[model samples]
Target chain A: MAKVNRSLTGTMGRSWLKDAQFTPLAFLAPTIVLLVAFAFIPMIWGLALAFTDYPILLSPKFIGLDNFRRLKDDPVFWASLRNTFSYIIGTVPPRIILGFVVALLLNQAIRGRNILRAMFYFPVVAPLVSVSLLWQWMFNTHFGVINGILRMLGRAPVPWLTSSKYALPAVMIMSVWKTVGWNMVIFLAGLQGISPSYYEAAEIDGANRWQCVRHITLPLLRPIILLALVISTINSSKVFEQVYIMTGGGPGYSTMTLVQQVYHSAFQSYEMGYASAISLVLFAIVMILSVIQFKYLGARTDE
Target chain B: MLRKFSVALSTMLALMLLISFAAAAAPAELRFLWWESPQRVESIQRLIDEYEKAHPDVSIKLESIPWDEYWQKLPILIAAGRAPDIMFMVSGNVQRYAEMNALLDLREPYVSQEVIDEMYEPHRAMVTYQGKISALPFTLTTVTPFYNKDHAAKAGIEPPMTPENAWTWEEFKLAAAKMKQAAGSPYGVGLGTRDFWLLPFIYQNGGAVLNEARTGSAINSPESEEALAFLQELVTEGIAASPVDQSVGDLFPAGLMPMSFGGHWDMARFETVITDFDYGVTFFPQRKTSGVGLGGDFLAVYSKTPYPKEAAEFVAWLTSAEANGQYIAENYYLSPRQGAKVTYPSRQEEMNLAQKQAELASVRLTADRAIPAWDKFLQVIHSEFQMVMIGDKKPADGLKAIESAINKTLQ
Candidate 1:
């Protein structure tokens, strides 16, 4: 009787374990296969090509590390690297600060709060291509609305898009406008997740609103803030569309960035191997940055 | 028996509909890809329709890609071994394609020397690389300077009507100064640093992009510096608009600026948009000689094409006098073929001007602009030109930098 009972229980346990593991795998197979085929396989292929001399029109010959050796002495690559770094530093901080402050403000009791929130979030939902195109007209050196208004105010016309001095800043301005709303939405959710009871408790302990925010709200929002920064770093580093559409990376290549260089080398010059080498350098830089962020910032909250 | 007879008759009629007029002959599908302005799509489609009607056994599939994206797509298509049978080629495109052994040589087997000689010299030279005719020039364009007639009239300056009578560098500057002094603020000339605009100045100053052998860049020489200095003075003196002030000057009505450099496509737009004012176009103002940059689109058959004869025949028909005349009339392009007779029915005057421009272009069109590294060379030149135009770099330094970059690319 004891043996029969044990055998039945073992059978039941095995069946339960099988069903638990089988269902999710069956559901996830298509997505996993697609990711491997499209993303992983291409990445590996690109990695291999980074070491070759594969001009797109010509047959690719394996010339190991030659592309990378050329990159060491390339001045244009260095200039583009500088411009990309400047773009990120110039745009990302403002975006995050503006977004968080607005999100904090909107979280409070205000008039037509939902409507205000919706207005702030509208640009986030709008397409980047359309937004950048609109900005292009707005930044036109002569007949743009901004210059028109400046002229009406008795000021000299500014060459917003044409001048090398101003073109990168103009692009940065557009990027900030496009991105702040997205970060605001994310920060808003994090702001809302904080319990009001903690604030009340702080208030009871003779803490002012600023003090309570300093001690409680910020600490609670740390993980979300870190995540937003990491994502912002990735997005700003990979900025291509805005620079491409607005400037064509010109006026002495003042606004040329890394991804634009990759695109130019690959598509325009037909130097695929060289482009891949540039891309790998970017990928490694991004990885190092991401790892640093995860280690220093992510460790604080995940623990 | 009567019902069975009726069913059999109906079945035979249905089978007849399934069979084409060519009687079970398999159609050879030729994919033809090109970039076209929206206005020209209808005309191109009409040409394709005519070609298809002429050859019942050959079906031509027309694909249109955006001009800005064509280079990016073309290489991928060729590398993937899925390139179209026939493609539209431009001056800078054929050299690369020919180098890759991707284009079929039209000199022998496909076309004869007599037929090639029928094209304008510059247009013919444009499609030739390594002594081989790689493609056939279908349309020609020479950069022409368009001036606002009303602006000139207001400034009491009568701009010259032909290259021979046009302003010298000093005279052009004086006219610009007079216009600015009269009109105020928007300036007189819209300076362009692009290849068509800047290269012509180099040619007009007795400079070419390269030596006759096309061995190296000639832009580092004294004449090239003189050409750049002329432009540099206009920029720094604030006589003409710099990119910092405005790029190619966004002045509209095509009539606000006294002069602007443009191509044939601008002719169509000016006709429509310049209704508020009147504009006149003339040959590029000369320095040492009257010259203009000549460039155009061409047709090339892919070496991998399954039906080379049919593709070549179609391209030949498309570039023939009758087809090209209609194409030019509808599309506002100048013809490349000798005696192609491109008469823009209502605008016979513009057609006459186009002929004059084409004639001027041939005098200085041959250069290193046809090198396989043409695109990269352009990039370096464009950057250096911008630097000089913006008053940031000295003309000598800019030219030296451009020459160095070109040498690096060539190596």
Candidate 2:
């Protein structure tokens, strides 16, 4: 009887090991294949391409550091970088602040609050290309409704997009307008997730609305704000489509973003290698910024 | 085991289905890519039907994309080694692609010597790259003066009929100012901040954007500076509305502006829109020389195309005088074929006006006089001209900057 029991136990143990081994592999196989094919392979190829002089039609020649060397002196690339930073610096804080403020207002007990939330989020769901074209008409220098309103109010018409001085800022304003709804939704989610008991406890302690927000709401919302910041930062850095459809990187490259520069170099100019180098630089910048934000905000969240 | 066997059987069936579908189609498919214009598409489709009747073996597939996405899409298709057999080619981009050997040399198969001679000299030259015919010109347009006859008459100036009779820069400015004064709260000329309108002036003043070899800048020359200064004077002296806060088309047709620089394409729309006022077309005003910029489309075959023989045959037939005239006439375009006649009774005046503009284009599109680095140079010109228009840079400074930028691009 003891010997039979021992054999059965050994068989059970074998079955457990066999089941454990194949289950994880079976589940992970698709994701692993996806990562290898789409992410890992392309990244490796892109990195390899950065060292070559590869124009799509010609045979790629290894020209070490030539593309990088060119980037140092390319005024357009530098200008694009500056414009990108300007877009980021100009776009991020306002998007976050405005988004949070709107989200806070919506958190109030008002009639038709849900409808108001839907109204704010409408632009987010509307197609980008359509909205951009609509904005183009709105921003039209003469016949545009905006200018017409401004004229009626007895103000001089602003060259919202055509002027180099205002082009980047104009694009930023549009960017903020298009995306604040999305960010507001996230902030609202964060705001709602906060326990009502904390506010109640604050009220019991004679805390005013401002003080309650300063002490309880902000600290608890830190992680959510950090998430919003990281997302907006990354997004603003890579701004392309709106600027592309709206300006085509013009009024003298005032609104040319880094991604536009990458696209032009790679496709239009057919300088794929040089474009890859620029792309790598952009990747490094994004990665560094993300890491810093993660460390700073991650530690704060932990505390 | 039975389930696995069933799965294998289904996969085999699917493969067989695909194979049969592929093998069943033996029709001659001629893929044509072009920019979006409903009228143009309808006309081209009619031509295609005619061709199909003539050659039952051929079936034409037309792909239309908007003008903005057309150029961007072509390169991607080329890089993917799946470009359309026949596609639209602009003069500015033809040479660049031809140099890369992306375009199929049409000189040998489709463009015979006799057929080539039958084409207008300017049209033939526009598509010739490195002594090989790279494309066939479909329509030709040149930037010319489009004037509101009422406004011009009010200014006490008759519209210039010939190149010699055209206004000088100074005279043109005075006429514009006089017109503006006559029409209260209206502008004289609509000065757009686009390179197309500005290039004719730049070239007419003997200021080449790039030097003869197309390797360096010539825009910093005294002539270019003079040209830009003249344009600036038009804006600053209130002879023309600053492009900053106006649409030239809206302003021009409303009889708010006397004259605007545009091409033949605008003629059709203008004729319909400007019923209240009479308008006429004339040559762009000359300075040191007569200069006009070439604007039009060309047809080319991709080098990677599998149906080169069929593609060449179709291109040859389409560019024949009869077919060319039919297509151009339907679309209200100026046919590149020498002596090709268009019969659009409703738009007879506009057609005649386009013919006149085409003659001016013939003079400008001559290879000997044409700027070889035209595309690259124009990018710089657009930027520099914008700066000057906006009063951000002095005209001379703008010219200098454009010259530097052009030189850099050429290098």
Candidate 3:
């Protein structure tokens, strides 16, 4: 028994130094180094920057909690923070629900399935800058196609991009339309992974289509759904381009997102330290949200 | 064989030293960088060619970056101690670069009293920082009201073509409403959505953006509130377009807007875009005074430039009356120099009014640049102003909010 234990320990301890194990790490070294250089180092640097007064053109001075203190009284900062959360809430659930529904429908062996799938996925492949620009034109109050359609329906044209009340909603609608396809593709992959035998078994047990979906499909797709939810939430929280291009965080601070604030502070204002502080707050919020999502959904997913 | 080898090596070494000396004797290479547009680039290149021709001992390498990317890259280059020998700066950024000690002083030997006297007082004030001339402004323009002739005729209103004939605040608003009603224009006037563009209104109302010492916002005063309230009324009544509704300056060219504020520089583009409508440039509408915000680019020498003397010489020459007048005339821009005689090929009538308006340009327009992070302050002002214009907040409330935000930056 002692010899067997010794053998197990020796093999395990020696395995990492062997060519087989060492080769994988050698291959991964470039990626690990790159990740550390680009991602982790900047993150740490950004955190450190939050504690200093760094004007981009000047040397950074240690300033303790001054930036954070300033942020507390900053109305724009508060408005942007509120907008970010609203954006996540407004975008993520709709994207996930719509994506899931579309995925379930497309999973059927219908005619033109491939063409339909490609059409839905087209938005995911289009460049975001152009997409945002196109949507900006489409959201124009008087001349836009959207407003034209509303007028044709005998409805008053909505001040989609101009009015503060509708600006955030307009941006969210564009974002959902742009990204729902991505989630659909993800859900489609997950749906295709589920075994058809489970449905057959449910059918043999005299289960109806709804029962089969409820008992079999949903339970199996639980982990994928949780994954999609978390990813969508994080992505929605970081929404910037659409708001930036479509509304420019205005008519008031209506469509301003946290990321736009970060860009504004850093590049526009050159207040790198304050920008870093905003970034840290954003990171912390995203981290907390992701942890809560995983904690709640991950448990059910595990079951 | 050793002796022969030694002699040959000595000969090669001497030749190498000669080549090194020849290289050291080459003309000083100075880098001049500026943001580019077609006419501006052509005019600048023309000046550079002339400068090079006159100063054979100095060579200049001209470089241009597109406007948006230029601001982003310039600061990084300056921070890295690789700034161009001479670079173009705007009046609003002069304070920033001066505060950073990135600009060379042009007061003493570089700029003469004759040259200083030739420049307009407001232009001189724009380049001055703490009693030192930090830059030499070349071309100057001011925001003026441009109107479509057909629309004005249709509305039966005469657009202000001179300072004396400029419309009063009430007349301007009433005329805008009239134009909207008669011409079927969506937005009768397009007030540009920018802090600088808004400054003309504030200054015309006898209001100052910042206090005497530039420590805090003075825009909370009754004068400024009244000015802003007028603007808010124009926007709320749909006499002027909101930035949200359409791209502000585009509507005029599209024939959707009857009147709009623009600089002399915009005339070139209008000459192309307004093919259908005959548009004429005029002075901004009057309040208490015909004060308009100045728009100009300055030539500044980098403090750390190795060829400071050459850079300063080029800057001085480029901004000289003869050189500057030719460049401005060619590009249809008003010269910043009071002594410079600029003549445009066409639109001489509009150019004359633009020149008159340029002289009336306000010093208070670029005063907020003295405050650090003025861009950020402008963002706050922009949003608050938008709220006021959209009737989401009162003018007084918006001004107070702007003051509070600006004061935070001051601290």
Candidate 4:
């Protein structure tokens, strides 16, 4: 009887192992294959490339720390860092606040409120390149519609893009215009999710609309706002196409971003290893900023 | 059931992968990259078809990028080790690529010395690097003065023809001023801050963007300063409209500006479009000397190309006098080959007149005289010149800034 029981147990265990081996793999095969082929393989290749002095035509030579060492003195890399930080700082707060305010305004019962919302959201849905080109024409110092209006008003036409002093700010203005609508849509969704009962309760407690928003809506929207802020921060940090299309990193590199610098270094300047080092530095900065934001602002979400 | 599904999916994926691999390895293909107008691209396709017919075993894949993205795209492709076998190049970038040894030398068995001599001296020199030919010269561009004939006639000033008869810088300024005064508009000459238009002024003033060694920026020299000051004077004195941030051709054709500086590449288009007014080409005015930036395209093969011999053969053939002359005549470019005549459309005389003006406007820094640092230094000079034109900085201060910037780049 004991031998029979042991034999049955052994058979059951072998069958269970076979089932376990195939089931999870069957469920996860597609994802595993995709990750290995797309993400893991490319990442390994890029990491290996970073350690080598490689011009595409020549054989790659292992030059371990040399690329990193050169990154220390690359002035363009540092300028790109500063420009990226400025862009993040300039764009994020205004975008978030404007998005929230516009959402709040549209939430009120007004005539053609839906139409207004659509108008506000139109820019976000529009193709970015088209928006950039349109803005470029609008900001043209001479024949552009923006200057045309300014001239009619007897105001001196501002050199919207040509001046180094105004190039970054002008780009930021376009960025804000193009992005505020999308954020507004997200905020609008978050606002709608907030139950009206909370506002009713606040009203019963003798609170004004401002008080209701501060005491109730603010707390409820914290998670959404934090998410928006993080997303916008990442988006603004990687800003490339608008600046490239509008300024081409011109007026003396005032508008050059880290990505543009990397592109130039790796391709135009033929310094791929150094570009990789710069990219690694950018990655580190993005990671650190993400960690800090999560620790401080993201914690409020759980509460 | 799960086992059966897993087995089928894996088998399907494996089969797909095998098919893709087979497709990838099916044929040896030559990738050719170029940038030209859509109409011109069509013309190129016709020639490519002929080439393919003669060499049935070889297949060519053409990738035509827009002009604006061509420079940016080529470098990226090169860095990625996916650059096309044959590609379009320009004088501005020839030095950059040649210095990096990214281009194949064409002076070997493919291109003959006789063929090289047949190319205009400047054109041949532009593609020559370190005593070796690096590319085939396809076209040559010289900065010629374009003026609205109606505006000139109305002002009672006939446009000058020869360099000697060409209006002096002062006379050019006065003529522009008179046009503005008569038109009751603050428009004289249209000056756009593109390097092509600005470099000629520096050349005419006997100012080199870089010193003779091409090691430091010479834009801060007295001659460069005078040139910058003269342009600023044009703006400040209302002899030319404030250099608008638009293409010079766009402004001129719109009848917003009377005189502009441009190249012959746009001549065909201008002739077709400017039916509202008569326009003519004249030699650009001189300061202390006459100079124009050499502008045009070059055809080059990549160093890593698998079929360098065949690629070189195609390049050589394309740049041959017969082929180049046809191309120029078709596309309105000035053929770089010596004595290659192009028959223009119904306006043949006008075309000849424009060609003569271009010859007269030809600057000292032809393809032969260009160095590797030419483009970078020219960019530095252009930025400084733009700053001066906009009254952001004095010409002297701007020149100093430009010199330092160029020196830093060279170092």
Candidate 5:
């Protein structure tokens, strides 16, 4: 009877362990299932579609590498690529710098500091489409607020959105304005996590505010900076809503971006295969940039 | 245990029988799909209600996707062989879906001669892909000039707001210049530099965006070049609104533009926004002849639908004189049905002008321009035209580039 009771208890213990192991998977099943359904399957399907002639209504035909090869001579695609890179180049650095500066400013115990921080972070929470349209009104030549001010200063009106010369610059300005706040918040978190002992030590060593930031704050904030940089770069690369709402990729395609091209090709042109190919390239570019960020500016204990 | 098992089995058997019986009793369902504006939804619901009341045994399901997602979602649905029974087709997209054999032919034994004849000549031509009608138009945009009467009075111009007294091309230019000089407005006229907007100028010059049979672009012809040059001249000389600097939205409603080449459909918005100034509509300015392009929402029955005849009957009823007329009056567009008169309770002049614009336009219109590759054509021309207007490309070079790009797209 004792041996029988012992055997029964052992079996119960083994069953309990099995249930414990399965509980985590049961909890994770929802997320894993969701990711598999929405993300994994779509990624594989898109990559598969890139090699075919899938024009939505028509049956997809396999024509391996033709879509990619066509991209070599495609001027619009090249132009959109150039514009996207230009957008990244134009907007990212300014955002990082402005965010760094603002984050540093907000970190200090200034008067109404919380209010000022909130004010700076407002644009981040605001919808991009609404702000883009607001910017459109401000950039209008004959009637915009900016041009109105320009005229008040006796300067000629600038054709901000309607000309290739100024449309991108205008978009960059809007992007910087819209994005800097989110970067600031991320950076503000990084700044708060930083120890004040380092600053005090630097102060004792006769370091000024600028020097303290240069030697201590910046070095400490490298990981956060890199994080912000990668996130912002990735976000800007996929810019379409703003471009669509503001310019519609017009004024001679000066403001066209890769995602916008993807949207147009997929929906308007119905060349889903080509759109998928362009998207794959965009995905590759983002992946490479992210890898580089992680490789070079990843977290280090010393820093 | 056996008692519980027996109870469950009986329940399962009962459920299956109940489901089968329910299926047998279910009415035939037809799904009607469309991209909706707020007003259009109400109108569609009313029409659906009317149709349902007429046929008690058949149920109509109305589904509306927002405009932005409709294009992407509809294609996926169609590609999966689960297309709506009836789908709303646009001018530029009709040829594409029709070519894919996704739409039923609304011709011969399916539609009567009287119903076909009731469709305006241009609208009739538009829905006929290859030789069979694939869709029936509901309401069409016939291009005409919408002018601010207060600005016209200030400019000391009579400003012919009638089809009989429609401005000639030279007269239109002079009117623009006069409006600028007299009112001190920045731009005399706002000509939307979009491809659809530029169609009137091309039509006015007897040039076309495509060759017949829809093989290649015919926009590089001498007439088209002349049209392009004239447009460039207007921009460079600061008569027409610059494509980049200001839009019709910025110029006209702001009391800065005297005349703009727009369509009757824009009247509703103008009525609301132009409170400071009074406006009137007129026929598009003539060159070789007065010209307008046909653009409209079309109703198409899906080729694979089980209720093809029923869908066709619903569409025919929806676009008929009684329905189309009432629909246009409510929705603010010109009816595509011949002799369909829509009376607006307010803004009757806008309705009257739309009718006149349709008359002037429908006589010499074809949907050949709204080919499968029309989007590509628009992209090419709009970019080149902007470049030309902005002094980046010479007019002839722009036309040549546009021609080359279009040919490539066609290939």
Candidate 6:
């Protein structure tokens, strides 16, 4: 028995239990356990739930692909998916471009640059609930500041939050204002990291400011921009708080997003299976979009 | 002398041990959970203190969650077997919880039939599920028309003070228009578009939202269509504030609207803020019938509570006339008890009018409204009706959509 124990611990399992690896593993055990318990296990369970009929009151029954089959015919599900995509398209590019432009302007020695940066960042730091409420008031049709300005200019008041035609756009505008600062700060960091000598060399070649930015700055910032795009698209696809607070996805189902639908299905309707199915579809969309972004942007970055 | 002193010390030690054991074994520590406004929470806490003082063998740990998160967390807690011994429930959730067997039936053995029958008819209906008393109604919030007196004076309209004097639907509309004409645009009637608030109109129009058997939709009937069209016209013609952009609570208190629909609970806030204008509560206008929406909280015992008998007794005590009177008087909320005595600190006239409205109110339940999925149905209702109110869809089309959606939920 003693000889067998020596061989097991000393020969085969010697490196596996070595101090170097064992110490790090011991240190990481808590985090790994937490991730498995909270994130990984729930993810696997959610995927399994998508294949069952779980109303949360009774025991779950395996229903195979019925949930997915139902999704194919669910109009609300289709509408929410369309709205999610529209939100991604409407908010992500404008945010990235505006953030970049603002970053570039602030990168120069301008008056009150620090104050301007802080002013831009304030909205990002504000609590989303308060910001959504503030924007709701600002978008009020009768006495809102926006309408106040419109009326002052002798123009008709727009029912910004109360109309289906403009609700999503209003949400998009608030989202951009609230989040542009985050992207700006990221782009500013990327811009500052670029070597000044590259710009100097380009300038010596009689390159204009636009050409210098076009060739050197844009190339250097490609990876950062890709990072922002992937992050923003994933986050924007899950939009809920603003739409929930501002319009409650209302005036019709015009402002409903995929995550809000998930909430409605799971909590409001108590259909866990259907909600999981919706979530699985959302997960696939986000994953595929991220992969496509990487495929295109990553290739350019490498060059 | 030393021996005597040692004996006395031993005796004292023995007595101390006995007292500590009694202290540890006493007090069952029942967990009570509820969702209410801060003012009501204080009132509930006082009731808990009074109950604890009266029953020396029991103590309560109070848990209050905000209304929005309460329903979402409650079923999960009950399913996990971690439910509170006593829980606050609403009328809409009573049927679902009873069907789930999560609530204790307060029938014969737990509560006598006489006591259950003693409750107001609508309140009794709210708690009854398949002839079983699922919960006992404690307080009620009934809708009444709250009007700005100054606006009414300007429009030369006397608000209805009694059901007999209630205006017809056409009269109500003409009055609203006159008020708008006198008091500028957006200052007429402030209407709420949610289904619960909208039910009064349907009821007054002699249209039921669901069939008699509660198996299908009755909202597509001509009566319902006319009722909905009338409401839509109020918004579209600028006789009512746009439900989309303005909250009636805000507009009413700001003196911007001549009249608005509010509940007994809304009186507290309105009383505090409407210093610029005097307001009065009265019966809602009548058409084919005189009716308004009825809703409130109920006290229920968790079926799985280890101390079921104690929990039931406590819930009974909490809803008793004496305890309910104290709570109602302090909060200005209406009691569900038939003859509960309560004295308002002020505004007795308005309170009396509200009480009259509640007495006329009926508890409206449909097959879809009683299920766990009713919240989703209400969301559909809100969206569909909002489309009509915003002029994107006709009332008939919206009603059709609602009918189909509700039938789908029933299935």
CAPRI tier for the interface of model 4: incorrect
Pick the lDDT winner.
Answer: 3
**Error in Å for residue A92 of model 3:** 0.9
Poorest 10 consecutive residues by lDDT, candidate 2 chain B = B362-371
Model 3 stretches with alpha carbons more than 4 Å out: A1-20, B1-23, B53-57, B324-327, B369-373
Give the local distance difference test score of model 1. Answer: 0.80
Q: How much of the true A–B contact set does each candidate keep?
A: 0.54, 0.29, 0.71, 0.12, 0.73, 0.54
Error of 1 at B275 (Å): 1.9
Q: What would the per-residue lDDT of candidate 2 be over residues A176-292, giving only the tens digit for each residue?
A: 999999889999999999999999999999999999889998899899988999999999999998888777677776778889988877766777898899998888888888899
Clashing pairs in 5: A162-B244
lDDT for each residue of candidate 4 in A137-172, tens digit (9 for 90 to 100): 788776789888999999999878877788899999
lDDT of all the models against the reference? 0.80, 0.77, 0.85, 0.76, 0.83, 0.83
Where is the poorest 10-residue window by lDDT in model 4 chain B? B360-369
| Candidate 2 per-residue lDDT over residues B1-411, each given as its tens digit | 999999999999999999998755666787899895887888788888888998877788999988878877887777777688999877666767777788888876556787778767766766777887877777766675677777677768776666667778877787778877766534677766566567667778877666665567777888878888888777666677654443455777777677776666676677678878888776667777666656567788887787777787788888776787766655566777777777863557655755765566434424423333455345456666766866678988888777776676667
- What's the TM-score of every candidate structure? 0.91, 0.87, 0.92, 0.84, 0.91, 0.93
lDDT string, candidate 6, A115-186, tens digits:
999999999999999999999989988768999999999999998988889999999999999999999999
Better of 2 and 4 by TM-score: 2
What is candidate 5's DockQ?
0.51
Order candidates by DockQ, high to low.
3, 6, 5, 1, 2, 4
User: Scoring each candidate complex against the real one, what DockQ results?
Assistant: 0.48, 0.23, 0.61, 0.14, 0.51, 0.56
Model 3's chain B yields a TM-score of 0.92
Q: Model 1 in CAPRI terms: which quality?
A: acceptable
